[model samples]
Target: MFLFRWPVCCFLLAFHKSAYVWAGYDVSEVTCSQGLSECTVADEMPLGISESDGADVQMVTAKVEVCCKDNAPCTLCLLVDAELSIHVGEDVDKSHSGHDTENDREEATISTASVTLCYKTPPTFPACKRVDFTVCPTELKQKVAKVSLVITNPAGVSFSSIVYIYPSKALHLIEVVAPSLNEVCSQNLQKSIKDCYMPTVNSVINQEMNQVELKFAARHKVCIQYEADGRCQSWESKTIPLHSVTPCLCLQVWDDDKPRRSQSCPFKNMGFLQKNVWQNLTASVRHGRMNNKGQMLLWNLSAPCRLEGEVWPCRWTSGHHCTEIEGFRQQLENTTWEQNSNVQWVKMGVFEDINLQLSPCVMVNLRGGGLHLGPFCSHHIIAAARWRWNLLAVAVLLVIALAALMSCLRHDFVKKWASHSFRGGCAEIGRKGHVVLLSPPDIHDGFSEVCGLGSLLKSQGFSVSVDQWSRMEQCNLGPLPWLHSQLLHVKNLGGRAVLILTRKALGLAHEWSRQQPEALQAGRGDGNVPQSPYSDVFMASLCLLLVDKRQGRTGERFLLVTFDQDVVQPPGSLPEPFQGLHLFQLPSQMKTLLCELAGGGNRKVDGGKSKAGWKWGILDGWKLKTKHTTCSQGAIPTQCK
Candidate 1:
């Protein structure tokens, strides 16, 4: 009985040792290759051990790997390795493996375990190759997602684990820089589209992310309303071609489907710069008061973008020699906008009188792009103040010189006026009522006519001083002394002095008086009283009288006349002094002589016929009787003695 009992017990024990038992399963470990989760998964997972069975079993772990493409959605892949544990009765073969089991009847038997994944925070995520998680959410706190994973065993029991998935850090410091004006004009379409780039610091930080390039769209148009607003109404929305000479240009950039803010008016200040340049150039050329002393011209310009260029001030000399101004050639650096310190003050040397003009020019290279832009200069040259002042001074000097010359030429007229003013008043000859008729020598022809002329003048209210009237005085004072005294009296009275000129006296005007008693002749009116002294004094005065050039062919205080018998006498035949005097033919010019003694020379008499009617009648009768008496004496009046 012992032997049979031992065999059965032993078989039962062996069966129990060979059989597997089912127990509650639990996930020992989980692994996720993606680092965006709150729960950590180990690299190597250790399978759980069945305590009663005394056998080790390994449970497969899963790796949650993520794959993404470009800026599109990201994918999350769950690769699971699962093994099923099954429990068999004691009759089952014991050679299945070396693993032993306990007496628990429940077991997980399926070869495959079903895994279900769902998100709690984020409702949906893309599948293996197409899954996408939020990289950057609107709220930073919502960037994390709660994911639940369940592993179902063949025993119908479920094992679940919760994981928090936080999205990976995304690119945050990205920026787009637009192309410059130089690139816009000079670059081709393909190169221009690729010209836009990220900011320097941002591109350095995100080296891998920087591979994602941006595209640009440029619109060239005029900025009509730049002052108040940027209103560029372009007719066509399509991109226009750009050139260096294009006017009123602007630019815009695009990033992917969305466009970035545009950078317009790359050359907005160009017009203002050009206007100021012209003004400065014109001012530089103009000559000032101290232009020859040299000066300085400052060039201050601004730009929206960086620029590289050269500038120079030039001078054109009298010989058409063109040369740059001294100390004014400059190479431009990266000049920026709105910086006052960038002003370049150029000093110019002394501009000689031979300099014809001056100007300045600027050569612009936009953005240091090597392409050369046309030079800008002024169109018109400005006249200098110093030159204008010089011309005015010369003109004034010429006018002054001309006036001086004219004054010198008319010195006689001016001298007379000055003398008259110096004397304190005008001469009152007619008002003095005094006249002197110095008689000719008694040997002269027309001696009676000479005496008659004095009488005729006496009838016209003149106090006539004549040798004939003054015979008693002449006989008492001797002829020479009396004659000298009468001449002196006429000068002191400011009176008129008349000398009756005859053909014989005029012919002997320049001859010396013969002092011999035989040469002396008695006057017909003198009654055999030899008047040699009177003749000598009269002839000497005639030779001394000379015409004054200053007074223009006339004397101030002398009157000369010839009788009708000497009518053929020409003024040129007389002495120099008498030539300027009017040769009056008697009776015809007798009224004119009266007008002369009345103060003005040969001027119109307002009422000579009525006021001097008696004088004219007596003078006409004397003239008619003298002519008749001479004709009766057998003397032809037309022929002078």
Candidate 2:
């Protein structure tokens, strides 16, 4: 969460910008002021590389200053966790050729390192704290390894800052003779073509210095890599080269515009060097080794050019006049007519191998030409492989996360784990114990009965809570866990819950519930009474039972309503806690059952109906006749009294 506060406007500077809110309060303001000196990698930090149990030693620190709304009522407690990401280079596909410093490469790997930048809750807003996240390898050999610092707050806001970190290996710019651009054409002519190394260029190539300057043929630019102050500045241009084959930079040959840290090689294309203002005007080679060496050449020469003098043929993505054009193996040699005469160029060839020339590949900045293939060292295959592996690992983690989300969306089963239990109070004492009806929406008959039962109970002075009626709108804020909390609240009120069983409920339960009966026999052919409930209903019911068991409560305050001729014998086993304990099992009985449960009622039942309920069941039946009822026809027993 990069926060740039516009107090009145209330804007947060991040990918998602909107009115800011933290916890539940409206955000008034947020500000960040960096320290006098930003955190950077230093050479003094690591003497040499050391691997501990197959892991490289890391050594770097990260810091930041964060402030929340100052005029708020109290200090906001922010819980933070951090991650340090370091970029490492992957191999240029064998089909192609390449490019970071050891630690400053382009592709990255999340450290196996366990690092977290943490601090105590700020006693005041606008807090300043120095957080050290993780250490990264200091032996960066690639061009520039990218390092990013990410800090996440519990409220779900994340702040990320990335800085490029270079390796400890020193960089040197040298001018070496390039391979003949016409090697293939020359070999065809049987001409023994040899390299032409300028005497001045050869001397500059063998020099053992930390920094050197060089001069190049006109109309070209060079990308130089080196260390200034403490950090690595890789591939930055100190001169400018141009297209259209004009000699504008050649005009500066006498300007005395010496290269300090001040030159801007903006025109493009450069090569060859020695140590004066003119020498500073050219490019360099990788400092240490030979194979890791570069082909000394400039980039972005305009057209009056073509491959075989036809179209611009090079493997790298190229341009015709400033418009980029490319495809797999789409070379200038293969392009048709008009396209050939129109190609414009940007970057050209690069760091030359002092001993190798016009090899199968010219070490050009495949992007253009104005580039420096990293330091002259054997490309580290291990580093490249690890970088690719990191990408795969991240992809796997994303797949797992996506799957979990899909589960939560398709069924209530997974939603039950959404931390709803953390909001305790489901068992608060004082209210009368109520009956909870658990069933799905598809089971119209069962849900109707459950609702009827609830009405009957309310008439008897006992309260009732129905899972479906809890304003699903408000509860949407939470998942099945929140809905389950409501059901548990009902259970803890006093009486346990009642589950309406049906083939539809059973089939869904088979899929959504964590545990199931050893076997299930379908009751689909039974009757019109067996209506299936919605998955949401099953979700709440299953969670209630599980949550109840987890709380370790006492008593079997539940009742199971089975609707078979022999409703006493259920088709499958019931979910635990409600598993086995002789309690009133309503087998095809409805109102009479409610009366018996409501306190002042007869304890006798016959043929799945009360012969004569004795008290409340009769009165409730009469009340249903006089008042509104969900199902009126044949619902209440006519001979209640």
Candidate 3:
């Protein structure tokens, strides 16, 4: 049985001899037998791989081939570029020289495997070409993706070092940096759109995860609405919407009030980076008031005084009810206070809660409106104070100067009044006169007759001397020997002497010698004189005697006139020397006594003309008449009528 089994196995083994699986680098060359054509190796031969487009993958026959043993009928099969399951498999038989096996149930194969990926002779990538890729879904964790890249090179050659890909989270972040991703993400189109939603990534920042930052610089229209109970309206709402249909759509920060106030709300989701918010927003901010209070800077003032009309009211309105406001502002020096219109008083420089990350702008809210506040300069305060001082000084000086001027004027008026009172209003008259009139002085001395006589005499071109009068009695002279001297001197100077008689003088006319001669002896006795009971004959005698003496000095005229309203005393009804003197009828005070003397330049009078006109005075004869006239028996003669 062993011999028979051996013979059958030997026959089967001899029939089932398999071909040797030989696979290695191909080392073949085409040759010319007759030594006419040059032989070339496969490496030197031109494969279509060298002439391929940068985007295509053209297969080149590798230096791998299948070989069989001598004279043995065998099958030889070869495979090139063995790869992973993810790759599109390409089975290429470089050569087939072996025959099929005796069993022929399964085909025999041989292949060569090398370091090959999806690579080209001259490797390059498309705009968004994905290179190494891997998806790692670790247990109980978000799946992490990994990707790697190779630099596209011009030279068609493999790199020396092997490449590797590690798991990373940055693969998702890389989408933002891709060239294809940049084309779709542009800037904001409408003013209502959120600034951050429109990405303007100038530079990539975060080398770390959450810290990946961007630089954004642009302006946005923002309007804010105040919460009913909030203290600050500006701080709460950043943007306001104009379109009523879309309350969230914000087109402008400020708008014409004609369409009424736009709906405003808090916009916390603005995507723009706040890094450049100060720089971008500063230009649009104006010098504006928080309340009605003027936009004023802090210098030094009362903390919470009522500004009234000077500032905007710090209040808020809801329906018909206005509420008080309590708020703080951000500034160089932070302060806080209440508003008056809002029911409390507030100050200009006030601040709120602060931190290191402060922005350049602050919110200022008042009753009627709210706005963002920008920087203001308070440096002019010092200079303004100086100006105020200067103005005050000028005003004080003006008041002082005006007071001094008024005082000077008052003193001048007092001095002038005193001078007028003391000096009286009359000019001084000395012993220089061409016509002299003797008359009695009265308490109320100024009379119309005296003034008319003086004026008439002056009009006739004679320098007349009468009484120089005043309201005071300083210049008054009572009858004295000096008066007698004045009358005699006037006669010596060829001046006229006129005697005037009033009722008082006429009643005591004859007693003139007894009363006045003693007064003359006393030489201007007593500034005042008492009235005396004297005879009219005595007065007439004295006047006659005086006239006789004065006429003896020169042939000047002696005017003796009786002013009696009761009777017309004719010149012939008089005593001896006075009988031919100028005698005329004179009504007491109604008319002036004018001695119708001579023509102009005659300088003479009718001393003794009664009914006969222009009779010259008998000077020697008047002395004879005065000697014959006696007084009282011890008295002067009464009268010869």
Candidate 4:
């Protein structure tokens, strides 16, 4: 009875501890073949077992199911303890030491075991059947125990009944504000705020309140708050009336008090319309009375007219009528005319003379009326009349004075001065008789040649004189002076003058003719002579020659001569009234005539005609021997010898 009772008591104690362990666990009633629990365990149990030395033992297995989130690893812990002790006999221990050692081993035996179970795939199980168990009979007598198993399912396990939890929800809020006025809206805000749900708070607040009269309130509570708090020191508020917007034009206008002559307008705060109206009105007023100004009345219209210091009333007159009536004389005068009120007219001319007393009107009447004339009127009329008569008188007086002066100063002046001063000096030696030479001073070579030729003529009993007019340094000498002096000199010398010229002098002569149209047209006593004869002495006989020093067919020096039949005419075949005079090249046939003149002469040669004695000899030699000589005429004729 004692032995049976002891085992019973031990079993009862073990069962009691196991009941406490199961009390802490939570289990599900709907357990599938693989399902989860809040807590679980695995155990090994042994029953009806004894040791060889009379020791009793039992084995038991217990497991606790630990639940975790699906797809996460789980661990289970099992509690194990010994339920009974083994007994060993003393005699058995002396004869055979096994009983005593068995009892000791039973006392030192462990009651716990641990196992690691890893689940690598999903939907892992915590069922009792899935639990792995192993028991050893020798180990069972030591103790019966519950062991812990760590089950890891890293790949996860899913359960239909498990509660799912989510992470917390939190966010940041951003508010964008815009300006009160659209014009002042921030560019960034205009881009960001797409929805109009957010209200725009105005920064400014009005302090004035709407007034209301109370009628029936017995008890009332009123809250009055200053929009700006105590910051407003003195409260005063009013509504301003809105003004109408107006369009404007930019313009400046002059004021009444400003000086009329000032260039800048003096209007202070004039609007566009007022300024423009004022400008138009002022312009009209000025235009109407402009001509009444004293200065305007005195203005010279013939010259450039001016308005407000700027050129105005621009017009030009060529005096074509005056020109037509006076012919070439018109250019020497200018005339302008203006009409005063009541048909009274005024005329003016520049640089003119007036002889009012000689007019057809009574001298008293003319003197009383003052000259009624335009700016250039008196100048024009007086210049025209005075120029005509004064020019004639001056010319006549100059001519008379020049004649008397020349007579007084003549006294063989050329013979005493320039006759022997030149190379080949002599009175004359040429076949032509009494030749006088004249030329401008610049052509010294031509002058020398003329002197030499004159000397040569003097040697042959011909009188020759080379005279020059005194050089006038200033160009102010009037036409009358030049003409009178030159003409007087020519008449004194019995009206015979020869002008020798080079190419350069010929060009100058042509230019002079062009510049003086009146002189070119001035008629001479002989219609054949140019109107304004520059040289007092015309070229009665002209010669031009080119001497060749190179050898000819006979190895002797030769001479080439050219003469011009049209020397009186300009280069082109234009009609008389020639524009100018110029020496042009003569035809080849003229060369033969020139050669004849130079080489042939028996008597004296004059005006292309030969005399009997010396001219006849010279003409015959020129025609017969020197015609085809091809040698210097000065050289002795080889054929003749």
Candidate 5:
């Protein structure tokens, strides 16, 4: 039986070796022959066995032929099942008669049943070309998941270490422990994972189970309403957070026992930020009020804010109706008065109608209800006690002062009267008599009038001469020789000379009298008289006043006129000798004065009435008068009359 069992066992062994049961390829010994060609060898021999145990073993070899079109590189692989067990200590001779053999072998015990062997010339494309990909469901939680990919070339190669499957989480954990490991492992894992994972284990655990819940508080609105019972009731409501799953929730409440005023509320004290919160609350209340019209009571309670015109009365009686409370009319009028009071009162016209009834008064009623009269009303009444009395006294004094001032002005305007008499008979002056008007130089208007008077006197048949004595350049009387000579000549010719002196000329005469006393006193009737050159001129003319008119009073009489043309009256008394001079103002009525001097006669002395009449009369009268005076009463008139 031992002999028969041995042959049977040998036969079974031979069958097992020929049947092709899978023994995993030796990965360490595998290699590519050319480029991509594949080959397999089966040998009926044991590859590795303990020599001492004498166990039989068999070996298989896969030859990978690698080739590329036109020398392009390629890849080759050999596959085997891991379920075939290989003894730990195994060796086999792979030498063949005509084939070169490079042998390296290893046996491994693996948990999974199948494994593959690979042989590759460095691939023409990169080995397991680095692939970048994106995955879905951006958010994720706990679990191991699969990711799929389609590769370009997946022929005879079976994946082992070349292609690996890993949980990104496990790889991450491993990376924490072994830092030197390629960071690509963790990076790939993160790329493959759908969810973000917390780095700390504790944080991840906490986040996975419990989430935080947040709650917000209420915003409150408060309103006060007047009740019929004369009590103010306050209604307060608060808005709850809408996100909370509760509706119609009362978050805050307040009750009022007495009437409350809006002004009395604490809201007024709350500054800007708090007031904004109140505004927000009121806005919500207003929204609620709008939505629930039927629930007016509730709406009022919700309406913490008041509308601009929404004040309500507490009671409803006949006299205390809402209308009786004043429909903004009284408020408007009061506001107008308050704003306008500061404006200044304007008097519209010279006599504005003022109301005494509306005027402010000082009198007051006594505590016993009796009215006080007159100015004794108040100690502070300044107008009645002091100002009125002072004003009346001032008015009376003003009247008396005004009357006295009028009397003084009247006295100034009244004309004063003067009396005088002539000692000599009146002279009948002929046209041959001459008049000389004198004036100062600086008073041009006065000098002009003197010139005009000379012309006027000449027209009236008098030989008139004007002496502008004030025009003399020298300050001394010696320069006035021509004036003295002319005066003497006119005097010798028996002609009259009128000296018209102005205020300035009168002043010069006083100065001349002081400087030239002899010339001033030459013609004085009495030595005691104050002398003036003007007096000398007058005396010379008086000596020549012995002419006679053919008609009227006839005598050796002369008119000596010393007229002052200045507006001021002469100062002090005139000398007795000068007093006899007929002084008059320069006649303002020139035509009337001329007519009076012409004796109202249209006819000339030597001819009938015509333009020639006045000229002829003046020439004839001069001749006749000169002859009549000089004839000594008996000779024929030698000069033509």
Candidate 6:
């Protein structure tokens, strides 16, 4: 009988303890699958009883749980020691049914008691047999709930514990204050290109609020709906990193099972650098008005995003110098392009001269990135009046330089051209006759002056030979023999002879005359006596003069001429045969000389008879002068008519 009774008592004790174990559990002590409870334990709070010194105090341990299972309603379960001695105040019973006299002192009678719960204030469940409260799954959607439980004993002793319950579907948004896009770009500039990432805009969102929270999931996205004609036209979604988030874009949170929420937009306000947004931006540039400060470059910026800041930093680079345009930023914020205004016309900078050749550009703050809204270039602006004046000045300088060059070459060029034209029979001479020019070797540049006279006569239809050009032939044939040959050739061609006389020539002639009288008296009148210490050509000329004078020959075959630069000796100072001949000064008496060379004695000649009746236009002013005067003769001559 004692063994059977002990086994029964053990079975009853085991059953009693197991009853409360299912209702009340310490989640830390037990795994979720170890329990007989069908609900999955979402959260649990344990209120462990402290050791009590007072015998009146009841020993109690309590725990609460928010539990749910696969799409089912959530329940708030309160678990407590079922063996605790507790009774409602009004329903207390003093009588006790003792299990046995020996066991009555060790175990207290289990009493029926009520537990009350209150949540969200004013909503209370009182005197409940079971401590389970049914909660709709949608009621606690992704949120936390705090519940308060109150247990009262028959003696009016009250015990209470607060339980924080989290439902199975509860979610929380962890707010993270991220760096702005500008700061991210700057900090990651040193990173490798393979590691560097640039975020592209997914969609343009119109946000009504300035701030909201983002819900992070497997796929983080920004979604926006564009409207047209009062209806939604299209939906745009973009994948973006957390760093690229801004208040202007809308966020959508979703999962594979179901879309948790949609239209969560205007993300939490992340401070931005307005200057950086415009740094990589593109815009149109225009020239600004010129003021007292100078000419300015105007940047017109119209963007969909908001631009608001105290300053916009930029650099202006020209050549090797870079200048910060900080003043323009202040000017931009203060001018018509106000803060929060999307459209702005900003004055980039001022330049002293717009016509400078410098190609200045505006550099935005984005250094490594490609050209943003600009390096706006500056162009040279030249006024019409100033350009015309510069052109005129250049033309005047060219004309002056050309005149100076032509002046230095005129004498030599005309001399060579006239000689060539006469040789080619292309001059006005037209192969008319021949003439010989005789010049004394003692005067300065006397031979060159005689050559000039010869060239002019050659152009007037008279073939002329001067001693300067024949010096090589004169060296081969003696000067006297050469002079004789030239005279014979002139006589055969019916051409006259010219003696270019100067002060030196007359002096030499006086010396020769004085010596000739001594020679004739010495019985040597054959003209072989040394007359003067002069060139053989000069002595030969004097010998010819002597022979003509002694023979009493008239000086019709010979004429005397002088250049403007030479000192013309008076005809009375000349010898007998030379004094009777007409002494013509060239260029002034050139027509008269030509007439005499044409065999017209004392005849007046008008050279204008062959005029082409056309004036030279502009070139007439540039015509070369002969001797001290220009030639007055026209194209044709009437000298021998």
lDDT of 4: 0.26
Q: lDDT score, residue 171, model 3?
A: 20
Top model by TM-score, which number? Answer: 6
Question: How does candidate 1 score on lDDT?
Answer: 0.36
- Give RMSD (Å) of candidate 5 vs. truth: 50.1
Q: What's the lDDT for candidate 2?
A: 0.31
Give per-residue lDDT, candidate 5, residue 286. 12
lDDT of 6 by residue, 1-641 (tens): 44444445444333332332343323212111111111121222222222211111122234443333344433334433321122222121234444445444223322121222111111222222223221111122232222222222211111123422222112321111222323433554413221223322323322322112333433443343211111111222222222223344343333334322344334434445232233213333435556564555554443323333332324433232335544444332323432222122233334333422233344443332332333333333213322554586458546755764586397575565465455532233322456877776544334445545655665444556666554433533446777877788777877767787766566556655665665532322223221211256655666566566667754646767777445455557676537556577665555545555665433322331221222212223331243442221111111211
Q: Is candidate 2 or candidate 3 better by lDDT?
A: 2
Q: How would you order the candidates by lDDT, starting with the best?
A: 6, 1, 2, 3, 5, 4
Order the candidates by TM-score, highest first. 6, 1, 2, 3, 5, 4
Q: Go through the candidates in order and give the C-alpha RMSD of each one to the true structure.
A: 42.8, 40.8, 48.4, 46.7, 50.1, 40.2
Candidate 6 regions with alpha-carbon error over 4 angstroms = 1-431, 520-534, 564-566, 601-641
Every candidate's lDDT: 0.36, 0.31, 0.29, 0.26, 0.27, 0.39
Clashes of 3: 41
Candidate 5 lDDT (Cα, whole model)? 0.27
TM match of model 6 to true structure: 0.26
The sequence of per-residue lDDT tens digits that candidate 3 reaches over residues 104-191 is 2112111111111222231332111112211111110121111112222212222221222111111211110111111212322223
Best by lDDT: 6
User: How much is the lDDT of residue 613 in candidate 5?
Assistant: 17
What lDDT does candidate 5 reach at residue 462? 52
In candidate 5, stretches whose alpha carbon ends up further than 4 angstroms from where it belongs are 1-429, 469-481, 510-572, 575-577, 589-641
What are the per-residue Cα lDDT tens digits for candidate 4 across 176-262? 121222322233333332221122111111112111111212222111111111111111112110010001111111223321111
**Which ten-residue region of model 3 has the weakest summed lDDT?**
632-641
Off by over 4 Å in 4: 1-435, 460-463, 468-495, 519-641
The TM-scores, one per candidate, come to: 0.25, 0.24, 0.21, 0.18, 0.20, 0.26
